[model samples]
Every structure is written in C-alpha cells, then in structure tokens.
Target: MDHLACFTPGDLQSARAPDLSSYHWRLLAQGDSWFSNATAKLNAHANLLQELVLKEKACVVNCAGTGEALAHMVDLESAPDFVRLLSSPEAPVWDGVLLSVGGNDLIAAAQTPAHTADGKEVPLHLRLLRRQTEWGPPSAGVARYFSEPGWATYADYLRSNVRHLLTLRDQGPSAAKPVFMHCYAVPMPRPAGSEDGGLGSSGPWLYPALKAYALPGADWAAISRLMVFHLAQLLKAMAADKAQFPGLHVFDSTAVPLALATPGSSGNSGDWHNEIHLNHSGSFKIARAWSEHIQNVLAPPAPVGKQR
Candidate 1:
C-alpha cells in the first residue's frame, strides 16, 4: 500500500480518488517539496515516526504537493475543486489536515523587490497596507496583471483561507477533524553548488532576498534569523487564537534546537540537501515531530477515575 502519493492539479482533476475511509487517520494537504520528499520516504523503516505509528496501525494519505507550487488549496478560491474531490464517493471524512503553505509564498514575496521595474522594493509599510486591505479596489472587469503583492498580503490570505476551510468542514462530515500545520525550519542562506550534487547551485536562496530588504547596518544572518522568527511567530499566533477558531494546531518545528543550528554556527550542511530542503537526517527529525504530534492527537483520553 502506498503511504504517500504526489499529484499535480491536473492529476487530481482527472485521476480517480482513493477511498480513504478504511485508514486509521486521513490527512489532506498541499505542501512544497519538503512534504513531498519526506512523506515519500515515510513508509520505509528508516522513517522513525512512520515506523512508530505503523505499530499502532496508522495509515496516511497525501493528496497533493509539488515543488514551487503554492499550497493555496485551502483558499476560498479553491473551494469548487476541493468540494468536487472531497464529495466524491471515494473520498472520506478526514481526521486531520496538514497545511504546508506560507513558506513559499513568503519566499516569493521576499524576492519581489529584486524583480521590480525599478528594482526598488516596495516600502514595508505600503506593502503591509496593501495586504491588510486584501489587495484593494475590487474591479470586476480589469484583468489583474503582473504586479507583485507583498508577503503580508499572502499572510492575510493564508489566515482567511484557513478560516474558510474550517467553516466548510464545520458544516460537513469532518467537523471534529483537527487542522495541523508547521513552521518552516531555519536554513542557512548558502548556495548548494556542485560541491553537493543535490538541488544544485540554487544560489543564496534567502541571502539575496534578505539582503534586498534587510535593515541597513544589520547583519544578514541576524536578518535571516529574524525573518524566520517572525514567520514562526505568525504561525503561533494563528494557532493560539483558539477563541476565534477551534481545532487548529501548529507544530513548531522551527523551535527544535537543531533546526536553528546553521552551518558554521553549531553544524554544517550535512543536515541539508540544499538551502531549502532537508537531507535524510534532517527530514527524519522534522518527520519525528510531525509523527509525535499526530499520535498525540489521535490517542484516546485516559479513563477518568470517578471521584470516590
């Protein structure tokens, strides 16, 4: 049995959906390359968390994830397709949904200033304003062109999309299902040149972006760390607002000690395949965290001893 499956948007539309009712835990999500690569190796004995859960007869199904694809399926704009897939006879009510969004969205926005006409990054304040307003001035007839929106806009969208998904599920068969998401682990902004034959020379993935927007006179590494820290905080804030939304949980993988140990600091690139994705050892660590979180959520409550 396949523990993980990857799908493209087209693949999802045309392919027959699988019956997930028999599985102990059903998961729905769209992640970047990290989720794809990690889960693909999950069924093997090498994956510590996967093996542990397998003992409890746990099974998981990965719906769709691909490199560079925005994990925007939770957005309201994706509702039609999401409904079509979920309503199919083969689909089942999910136990949890793992959301792997926002990271790539942030990365894209980080690079936007470099790609602009004048090569001047939009002021952080103005960019934040645009996002806060939800991209502003709704025009029905005008075709949206190639203007770059800021990360804050995407952040707002991510939060809104999650709420929409929750509402949709709340009205359906999966009302009790919990939503799980993770904070991206920190990465050293370095190039993966021919020295490592893996995600080759994806030169300075975060460095250039951080350099472009970092505060003047600030250390680039510190800037990168701060950026990552803020992203983690954003996720935590979203998870903590339980009064506003329920059944939402976040796994703070970023807080794991080794995650912050960049090359020349506490460790080297041995834990990384590239500036972005993790190597086997690194992926295993993240997977273990995910596995533990899932197991804890699925565990039955201890019997309450009656007051004697």
Candidate 2:
C-alpha cells in the first residue's frame, strides 16, 4: 500500500512536475496539523496526507500547516499560498481538494481559560466549558458542563468559514470540484502531551480546561465524545445542504474503530499519540477508510455486465 506523493506549495511551484500527466489525480490540500506534522514526538513521519492511500496514483500539493486555526487558514491575507495555487492565472485544474480542519478550532475554543491572565472572568460566549457553578441540571449528561451560547457561537463560526472556503473555491480553477473533509475520533481528557525530550510539545488540551472548570474525571471521556459528536453533526449538515456547498464531501472518520486511550495516562496509549492527535497506526486506519470513501465517490464500480 503505497502512499500518495505530497509536496509543499513552494516545492511544487519552484519545480513543477515534468510529467503531471503521469498521475491519475492532481489534488490540492489545505488545513491544520492533521494534514501536516504538529508535534515531532507523535511519529514525525505520520500525518493524514502522508498516510493517505488512493487506489489510483495521485500527486498532492499540500498547503496545510501545523497548529493553524480554521479562522487563520481561511484568511486570504494571512494564508495567501492556498488562494494563489487555487485561483491564480497559472493554477492547475485540480481533481479534488482535501481538507483537515475544524479540529484545531474546536481545541482552541475548548482550552479557553475560565479567567484571563489579568484575573478577569471570560464571558460565556468566549468559553466552551462552563465552570462548576455554571453547570446545568444533572440530567443534561455532558451538556451540563458546556455553555450552549458558546457552542452556538462556535458552530456558527465553523459554518461561516466553511462557506467562505467554498466561495473561494468557486472563484478558482477548481470550481465545482469535489472538496473532501473528515470528522475526528473522540479523545480522552488525559494528561498526555505530545512532547518527546522537549523537541517541541503541545496538548493535553481538554484535560487542563476540564480541570479548571472543576469537571469530574469520571465524566471527562463522555464530555469529549459529546463535543466531537456535535462537531461531526455540523460538518454533516454542511455536506447535506448542496445549495450552500455544492462540491463538499465529508466522511466520518470516527467510524473507524481505533482503541481508546486510558483515562489518566500521560504518554502514548491505545491509538492516540498524545491527548489530541492520532498515532501512526491510528492515522493509517483513518486514511485508509477516508481513501476508500474518496475512491467510491471519484471512481465508482462498473456495472455488473460492463466488466471486460
């Protein structure tokens, strides 16, 4: 199972492939750390793009960066490379566009401190998790720990930015081409952080926030699962409304059965490399499932009688 050949925008632009015709599909990808390596400790060689295996050979030009928020990625002024490659006069007609976003945005919102560094209380709309005193009735399950107003704001932000991205695509050479995205697997709120000898470290994003809000350790996993479910549902809604996003396609990567991490482990456990990102094995599982879905969409099976 060979992976697709992926290159950065600079690499592709400086040295255009001598034979673009050789590849079955030419893809343009952009998003967050999932499409690029976020932490060195979590299998430096493994990211979504690197792990993706298509039935037909494809050359992927990736513009995604590590730790980039969805807001930043869609900002034309901040990230010009994506726009330049997709809409410029010299832009190629991409077969499809791959995206791995929304996760970072969710993480950013979830990790917001209840109080600011200056000792000011952050507004409810600015915080995803509610403090112990702010929790709703006990019957609400994981919903009790979250602020509805904040979740609503987060949902709206995701919808609008995705719309902006699609609108941008419509303005480019790849208009009406399939744009694929995927949902994330639920994560455990543990003490795990992606740091190996301090080369660079990140995460345990949910744990700190949960602890700050005085959430019980027993409910951490359910709370995390609920948040991911909400995010997944939002993406599904966007994909279903063809009027808003004509070529948008989202596959549920959460359907893949990766092992769950232990409740309090600080290092690699199950399929997770750290608190947020998947390890090599887990990424491979997701990439393979997502690749199958992409293949079914782009190249459906031939009719029973049409076989040669």
TM-score top scorer: 2
Clash tally for model 1: 0
For candidate 1, lDDT tens digit of each residue in 1-308?
A: 22333333344346574444445666565454455433332321122223223225344444443222334335435334445434344445767766666676656555555334865646553232122223324361111111223446666766886677667667666675788777877777654421222322334556555444432323444444555666788778888998655888888877665543354332236566556556567767776766677667766445678434
Q: After superposition, how far is residue 39 of candidate 1 from its true place, in Å?
A: 11
Position 239, candidate 1: lDDT: 83
lDDT of 1: 0.53
lDDT of 1 at 223: 42
- Provide the lDDT at 296 for model 2: 79
lDDT by candidate, in order shown: 0.53, 0.81
Q: Which stretches of candidate 1 lie over 4 Å from their true place?
A: 1-21, 37-55, 66-83, 86-90, 118-121, 126-154, 193-204, 213-218, 259-268, 300-308
Residue 107 in candidate 1 has what lDDT?
61
lDDT of residue 227 for candidate 2: 89
Error of 1 at 151 (Å): 6.7
Can you write out model 2's per-residue Cα lDDT over 145-180, one digit (the tens) per residue? 988788998988888888888887788888888999
